[model samples]
Target: MSAVDEIVREWTAQLLDSGSVAALVAGLVALALVLHRATWLPLRGVVTIAHEGGHALVALLSGRTLNGIRLHSDTSGLTVSTGKPTGPGMVLTLFAGYPAVSLLGLGGAWLVTVDLAHVMLWGCVALLAAVLLAVRNVYGVLSVLVTGGAVFAVSWFATPAWQALCGALLCWFLLFGGVRPIAELRRKRSHGRAASSDADQLARLTGVPAGLWLACWFLIALVCLVFGARWLLLMPQL
Candidate 1:
């Protein structure tokens, strides 16, 4: 048989033999729901902390004085300093948060994939453990756990194609989930008379527009999805 014939035959057999199509569809649905919930939940606080902390740490290490730090109830806040940050410094600080959080989650997914083909299954368990541990506020923990559970269940029960679909969906959720709340918080703070000077400073220093930042984050997340799917596909079955 020709190489093309052999390749087509293999694909045809896999498609005919594997009960993955239905599973894949189900997984996609579950992933969609999880992403929707994640976008609405108030998980931006954690992201905010990571973002501002990145700025502060980079600044301190770079020999800049740390003037002040403010965290808000909505998970969007500012880090202030006496000296004006260079363009590069400001850009780094502004863009650091999403990448940090996304990378951490992606790392977690990678670790899970190393141990289990169905990494989302373990992701669910880890999230549940975090909820029990009070790793963050109750709402935050619940949000993570619930979303993780949905993804895990879908991945575990579905076929490989479904798992890939679900992973892609969750990636989108993680990417855009925190943006709306953060933007809303910024707007409210900007107009309020009680807004701190640090808020204004934060607004100024983080000069990258919110829409642009969100787009960049989504792009990074899409890249992560591709990596995650490859990892899933390569994992050995249990």
Candidate 2:
């Protein structure tokens, strides 16, 4: 068979066999990385990227002028936009960050469930590329470039098995890792810390308690995790 035909055959086989040993091992490794603080430090930037991208996306969509995004070393990001100081646009822009990561994770896992792992990886690359355009800080630029480059490398050069492995790992990371920030938000709220957090901002904007916002964010993350686990793990076993 021709090279193109052989590659297509290989991809088809990989798609049909999501229960492969490689996928299982990759998932375990991903879980370990997400659970360990040392590994989480570097990878946390991925969540931040999604969070800030969400803010930027909503800002532009809501008739706001996009300022820029800043990704800090502490795994925190800031997105600055100019718009009506109060209204649906402001509230939506503020509301976008936490759920963005969870939704991205859930979407990625769903793609893998449907055997579209490669599509998810390249889609991430596309997302990072789009986010990079709004990054105004050195760290933000580097974070997007490095993450996008790694994903691009895998999508472009890796074997189908390895690509699938990378895709699964990323899906798991996005699925599980997205929940951490919500936990952190809860901790902050309990300890009366970070009064300027997103939850706090939401509180001030809507006159709702920050704790309620935290609970809402936690619920969204938990729901995403449950559904993602079902799709990624339980469905495959059945």
Candidate 3:
């Protein structure tokens, strides 16, 4: 078999042996529900903050001015004063959101794995401590805990091939499963406005088509999947 086929076979064997496939499905459902609730809480504010920060960071780096920033109970917004970004820049900005966060998480996991086992353990502990210190909200704390657990579990239990499969599955779940509820919530909030004005403005300014932007995001997501799989497969065997 090819390497990809071998990986898939091994993953299936492991899943069947552990009976984790069903459990994983249940866990994903539960996670989706929790994330759906989280969207209704102040935690969404953090996501919004990250999103706007992404925009602000790119704008500043590209020599644009920050016109204003608005934070509301439900959403956060930013206005940058600059001409429309060029095609590539606009695509880069839009694609930066969750992938940036995922990359940060992957980087953190890598750092933990770089040294001894005790060092990795200590790194996880320190990260947990930092989360407790920085976040005041219980929901935020829970989110951090859940995310940390996933990282630790992937690091400790799964082989690299399994990790890659799990990461890809998780990413797919987030993009399709999580996005539906989020879009529903957004539609409710916006009174069924199909097109967001901000997105329209962005498209107009960048002169980049929305479909093209989405295609770029998909490409980046694929790259991330490959990286995630490699990280899992190449992790030190205990």
Candidate 4:
């Protein structure tokens, strides 16, 4: 058989044999990271990647020209794109970050529920690879490389159970991690710090209160967490 055929067959088999781990365990692991400063610090860079990638994805989808992405050392990131600065596209680009993380967590939970955690692990590797091409700084390049390499190793070489655990941890992290930043933003805004945050940007674009935008992001994240937890707590049907 040709290489493509062999690869396809292998993927098909893996898909059929996909596995899942205990949702409680994964959730707890992610919870530790979310609640602890030291543990969360290292992983914050990964969440920042997701946040910036969300902006980049929406920018492209909304017909903007993505310039490059910068992931900073402090777990902050910026995605620059050129387009109309005050239209629906811009609003969408500004609004995509928080929702994107929660939605990804939801997606990961759904994958676990459907016994496709392995698939999502590979999917993350592919995603990180794509993000790597657009990373504009040395730190961003290294971050994506390390993150993608770890996911690739897990997807390609780990046992199905380990893959499921890691996959669940990733998704669970997204779910929990998605919320902390919003709360931080709200606090900063109240203190007049994050005057240029995403919520503030949305307010500027749409003339709504930044607090309102924060509420919306917070609500969406909570809803996603609820749904994800529901999927994870219940035993996988498959």
Candidate 5:
């Protein structure tokens, strides 16, 4: 077979490969740690990367010039853009964070379905590199470097099986972990704090209630979580 044909064949094999129960178990363990507040300390930055990346993507799509994206040590991120402050673009940019991580995980699952786990890892490397160019602060730079480096390491040194396992676990974590922040946002809103959250910001910009935005996000995240579980795990069984 030609090179392209060979790649397609390999991809087909991976897509059809019924992953072992051990692999599923591994992902479950990782999911637990990724979801746990205390154990998620180190991996929190990855979630922030997805959050800020979502904002950056919508900003670009909405005809804004992305000024930069910052990832903080505290797992908070900011994406700055220059554009019309009031419009669909701004609303989408604001709405991107909560859904971004789950969407990203869904995208990753799609890649695995197409037998492109290595592509997923390499894609992370490339994206982090781009984010690095826009990073202005020490923490942001460090965060991008660490994440990019680890992914690059796996892509370069790990076996295919290891890469596949890591990819699945990462996808599961993002799908499951995406809801935690939304719950926290709801709690903060209920407590009369977090007056400056994205949902509240959207409410100010669009005249909708912040709770409604939160509710919408909650529903979307829950859906993504359920569908992602089936797509990444259960579907392969059938």
Candidate 6:
């Protein structure tokens, strides 16, 4: 067999083999991060990337022109686009932010169950690379680069066991981290702040109440978490 064929055969084996990594341990570690503010605060940057990426995705898919994206130090992000202010497309673009993390978490969990933990990490690196392109601020650029580098390092340098562990931790983080921001948003909205939140913007665009939209976001996250945990833990044949 040629060298190329040997490489393909090896890679194919890696993709099919489920490395030994306990999902529960990873989930517990991620839960701790969510509970501890100091750790969770800095890590929120990853969530911001997913949030803004969701907006950017819907904008482009909706045929709107994306202006740029900005990731702030405070774990907030902005995605600007040009299009009709009031329509399903604009509403969807605005609405995608809060649910994005959970959606990603769910997807990652599915990949792991199918013995594709390695593929999941590489997918994250690719995603961050794309997000980096639309970043307009220096901070945003640095944020994406640092994040992508970390994932790339783990995916490339780590042993398969360690990579599987990290992948589980990542999915768990997304699953748990998905709910915290909505809680914060609820607090801000209760205090009459965050008038510009996605829920609020959605309210302005549509006739639905912001509170109702917030409820929907919460439900989506919760549902994703429940099902994602099942798949990650059970490792069911798919």
What's every prediction's RMSD, in angstroms? Answer: 10.3, 5.7, 10.1, 8.0, 7.5, 7.4
C-alpha lDDT of residue 135 in model 4: 96
User: What order do candidates take by lDDT, descending?
Assistant: 6, 4, 2, 5, 1, 3
Q: Give the whole-model CA lDDT for all candidates, comma-separated.
A: 0.50, 0.83, 0.46, 0.85, 0.81, 0.88
lDDT accuracy of residue 7 in candidate 6: 100
Steric clash pairs (candidate 5) = none
lDDT score, candidate 6: 0.88
Enumerate residue pairs that collide in model 6.
none
Which has the better lDDT: candidate 1, or candidate 6?
A: 6
Query: Which residue pairs clash within candidate 1?
Result: 24-162
Cα TM-score of candidate 4:
0.89
* Model 3 pairs in collision: 160-232, 160-233
Clashes of 2: 0
Maximum-lDDT candidate: 6
Worst ten in a row by lDDT for model 4: 12-21
Worst 10 residues of 6 by lDDT: 12-21
**lDDT, candidate 3, 142-204, per-residue tens:** 655665676577757876545534443443333333233334434543574535544444466
C-alpha TM-score for every candidate:
0.44, 0.87, 0.45, 0.89, 0.87, 0.89
How close to the true structure is residue 7 of candidate 1, measured as C-alpha lDDT? Answer: 100
Better candidate by lDDT, 3 or 5: 5
Greater-TM-score candidate between 1 and 2: 2
State the local distance difference test value for candidate 4.
0.85
What does candidate 4's lDDT look like per residue over 1-238, in tens digits? 9999999888656543433335676788899999899988889888898899899999999999999999998888999999998999999999998888898889988887777989889888888888998999999999999999888989999877667767777888999999998888888888988878998889988999988889999999999999988877663522
